[model samples]
Target: MTLRADAAGRERDRERTLAWLRGVSGELASATIKRLEETLPWYGEMPPGRRSAVGMVAQAGISSFISWFEDPRATPWVAADVFGAAPRELLRSVSLQQTLQLIRVVVEVVEDRAKDGDDVLQEAILMYSREVAFASADVYARAAEARGLWDARLEALVVDSILSGEYDDELPSRIAALGWHGHGEVAVLVGTAPRQLEVDTLRRTARHMDADVLIGVQGSRLVVVIGRATPRDDTPDGEEPVSFMTIATALEPSFGEGHLVLGNEVPGVVDASTSAKAALAGFAVARAWRGAPRPALADDLLPERAFAGDPLARTALVQRIYTPLKDSSTELLQTLWCYLDTGRSLEATARELFVHPNTVRYRLRRVADIIGWDATHARDALIVQSALIIGAMSESAATRRRPTRR
Candidate 1:
């Protein structure tokens, strides 16, 4: 009985030793990782105490192996299976069993703490991975903070100017002062996210595209983004959502869903702000016509953009006006481009291309012969103009899925 009791006590001590060793190894592993983080692209930053505590767990696991009355090298390797690294290498040429024994230590500590809780290893990985991803949290925080300040200033400018009812004169200077790059033409982007959060998302998205963002927000649904559109955006036709187009498409799934609309670029924010209203109107119009899930176009709310965003207008025109030339060989697309560019002046168009006016006249005649409509007539001219615009904007010259105009 005495000998048996001694054996049981020894076994109990062995179990305790293993548990402690595991914790030490896990802590040491984490510290090694932390020490190597700045060099590895993956080291995330967190509170120093938290970092150290995690590292210490693995460190304890390693040290316990050396003192647990085992051939430390041989024993650490036995723990390799649990710690998930070659314990032999970890324990400096120790056999796999020695390392694996240490891993048993870690698993015991973790299992004890989390007896009825979630997986500690997984939780540890999650916590560690998150910390590592934002290694420069302070830098991003500072940037995001500055971005917030800028947004507040801009939002105030928009609301103040509009409230004072001086939108016309105050808008241009107010916007230009924000440091936007392009001067010739610019588009408008409205967002569903709040100004502060949306600003962060947009800034991140812009950084993804190697650019910066300028922003303003009015109410919950009104977010204004000012930046150069780039080819890098995955949106169709480079129409940014929230920032440039419908909010739904602009926001990544990481952000969730909603609608956004981009307005046509106007001369100034006076016009731009007005255009935003028009863009909202365009969204409404496009929705009334195409319903939700349809892409709203800039011309949907603009005057001359009628056919540009008008679905039925173009289709009716295509079927009624251009059926004759649908399969013709008279180079109709070229003919239409020339006609529109010249403002329907055969003499001017022919002269610009050094073609005989009679030849220009004859082509129009052939166009009429094929389509059974003379473009020289104002009604016919408008219909042909629709066809031309659609042709320029779409994939095929033959026919098109009327842009999701709403």
Candidate 2:
């Protein structure tokens, strides 16, 4: 049963080979030459092994064509060498003379089939063209790789150029040559993930922010470049200043066992390299936080507010957190402040403000209604109070506003 099955499979293979040979013949006259002509450049450039393969195809095709044209009976088993596979092995079960005779019969049968129909001997000439098509596809894939390599080299050069301070060259064109665009604002974003979630989440967040990002692995570190990073304005009292602490606080929970450092906002290529260096410094801060862990974040590394929580926190309190009520309706805000100062006693708040306890209650409720949250809740109230203090003080510094208190 096994021998019969093997014989049937061989017959099928031979038939398929003949069918391909017939199709190839049809393409020879005009089509085959035109197709191969396009690949000549690439073919000539291919390595010796592949070039030899093409030559072998051409030789076998010539021998087969000659044998078919003259006396098929004189053709040797060596004719199979063109398409590869040893002719002797292919004709192993039969003698060379018997193989020659079989070829004569097969050639006569094919010719008779073509005489009244289409001549397929033309396919032999088309052989290498088909092989060339497959080879050319590979060349195109390699060309894509070359483009990627070119881009990587160009990026390295751009980094060196920037480091050397020739600030006006067309770096974007160099990047684009490697088939990438440095769109929007170019800035550096650095992330340190001691946990796996930190790196992945940061990547997703950067993408959500519509950044052009590139990530690289350096030993145990993951380095990332994010483009178009607008400076985060964290001051909420309508001040134009930036607060790195707020940035850290906002990003900390999502950091998931990693650290986040917001580098300087570098909106253009001229400043991106510098910003990248600064961000690296911020990463140093993140490393330090490993010991202290004070709700730590990288924005804590900023030059001015790096020491925000102690003496500076108390000194800046009046100007930072209280000033928001100065220009607006101070009643509800003042009552809310006094209530906190009086340790949640409405009577104490009323006594301090020379108003009824009911008036303090009404004002506190009004404050909650305006701010969209009931700040009386222990946790939420703390969050609001912190936000107000931070917003007022930080925004004040950002805008160069004179402090209302000291």
lDDT of 1 by residue, 36-151 (tens): 44432321353455434434435544353334334334443322222332222222222234323333444444445435533433354344333322322433354457866885
Candidates' RMSD to native: 17.8, 15.0
Error of 2 at 21 (Å): 14
Runs in model 1 lying further than 4 Å from the true structure = 1-151, 159-165, 168-173, 176-184, 194-196, 207-213, 229-256, 267-270, 291-295, 301-406
lDDT of each: 0.49, 0.49
The alpha-carbon deviation from the true structure for residue 141 of candidate 2, after best TM-score superposition, in angstroms, is 2.2
Candidate 2, residue 87: lDDT: 31
